[model samples]
Target: MALKEVISEFRLYVCNEWISKIPSHRFRNFYYRKVMGFNIGKDCSIHMHCSFDCAKNLIIGTNSVINSRCRLDNRGTISIGENVSVSQEVIILTADHDVDAADFAGRSIGVRIDDYVWIGTRATILAGVTVGKGALIAAGAMVTKDVIPYTIVAGVPAKVIKMRREDLTYDTKYRRLFQ
Candidate 1:
């Protein structure tokens, strides 16, 4: 092998190690966002192993965290609001292919997560879905429809499971303790 190739590989290894050592909480203000054209807000955390496809179209608000191993297909403008938390292995797909079509490829719609929303572990927000402010989607829930504000949703198609109130302090405590 060429000496140049060996040096390139070594450089990649060093860069990867350097990135890995950084705290996961700094992604909200990451400098790489400018290169990718993504608009990231203050005090947010986007952990390692998460992939943003349409980085230019992604807008992350203040105090949000997109956790480890989560994949975001942001082709069509993804808007995430303040204090939103998405746990590990969650996939937010902003596009889809039509299975019934003969020459099918795909299409895009984008996703919106409003303020104070919490998406549990491994949850999927499908194309064209809107999660309203203060909504909570449970772990492993497949959200196909719009989640209403202050509602707690869970299931395959993610039906409404319960309600959350801003004044209610116990619900936050319950989710923190239980989930």
Candidate 2:
């Protein structure tokens, strides 16, 4: 094996071992913010200084890259798919206060990001949102509802700015939402 490849593999092992040893409460409180409770998938890249509240309700897929300081409160259920990339400071909040103010904090919802979705920097994904497979959510977007599969959305209350037209069909390699 190449030196670089071996080094990289070794580094990953060491990091994973240390991360596992980290007390979920201690890390979750200050840095990781309750990490041991969450189900972080294999080969997932979680950058430093990130926080997750609902470690119990979180299921991250393989090869996902979660950038620094992304907060996911999976009050209901937060499911992130494989090969997804969430940018820095992105907040995926699954809990919400009751809009009908008679009772506060009485309502909540879940968020789901399907496989291969790209979430831009500083975007806020509100409750009950399902970003479909291969969807591109632009930076700083306020995703209020379900994003369509293979589409690109942007702006506050994110709208469908473009639908992805790839050379191969969704059934080919990145099949999930379509087919």
Candidate 3:
């Protein structure tokens, strides 16, 4: 294999197998910021058991909390804004294959989650989706398109259920002991 491919494989192994399993938040954040080149902001806590597709494409803002067992596919890019709360087992994808293409070629687009957004447990945010600020994604919702600001969405291929309160002032600064 090529040198670049080898290095990529090694990084993936270390991040998924070793770093994700580490109990200390400092250790994992240190590796992720310094070694993996992710742009993580202050007071951001990414819980254990979370995995990533790539390293450098993620940019997280301050005071955000990513819960455990979430899968972040940063093959394109993932821009998460401040005070965001990503619940457990949430899957955010930034890349997928185009089934309509003749060769089934791959396509990638960044996923953007605005400030004060709260994504519920097991929610799946698809590629190229832009979740608006103060929006709430219900549990198990499969978001396919852009969500409007201050709205509540639910169910598969998630549709707007209701308007959310515009005065969202909660800070998502959660730090669980030992992940």
Best-fitting candidate, measured by TM-score? 3
Model 2 vs. true fold: TM: 0.72
Candidate 2 clash pair list: 27-33, 28-33, 28-34
Q: How accurate is candidate 1 locally (lDDT)?
A: 0.75
Question: What's the ranking of the predictions by TM-score, best on top?
Answer: 3, 1, 2
Candidate 3 Cα outliers beyond 4 Å, as residue runs = none
Local error of candidate 1 at residue 143 (angstroms):
0.4
Better of 1 and 3 by lDDT: 3
lDDT of candidate 2 over 1-179, digit per residue (tens): 99976765554344344543443422422323343345656556566545555335777787777776677766678889888888988999888788779767556687899888889999999989999989999999999999999899999889999887543222111211111
Instruction: List candidate 1 segments past 4 Å from native.
Output: 1-31, 168-179
Supply the global lDDT for candidate 3: 0.95
Each candidate: RMSD to true structure?
6.6, 12.3, 0.7
| Selected candidate, larger TM-score, 2 vs 3 | 3
Provide the lowest-lDDT 10-residue window in model 3.
167-176
- Residue 41 shift from truth in candidate 3, angstroms: 0.7
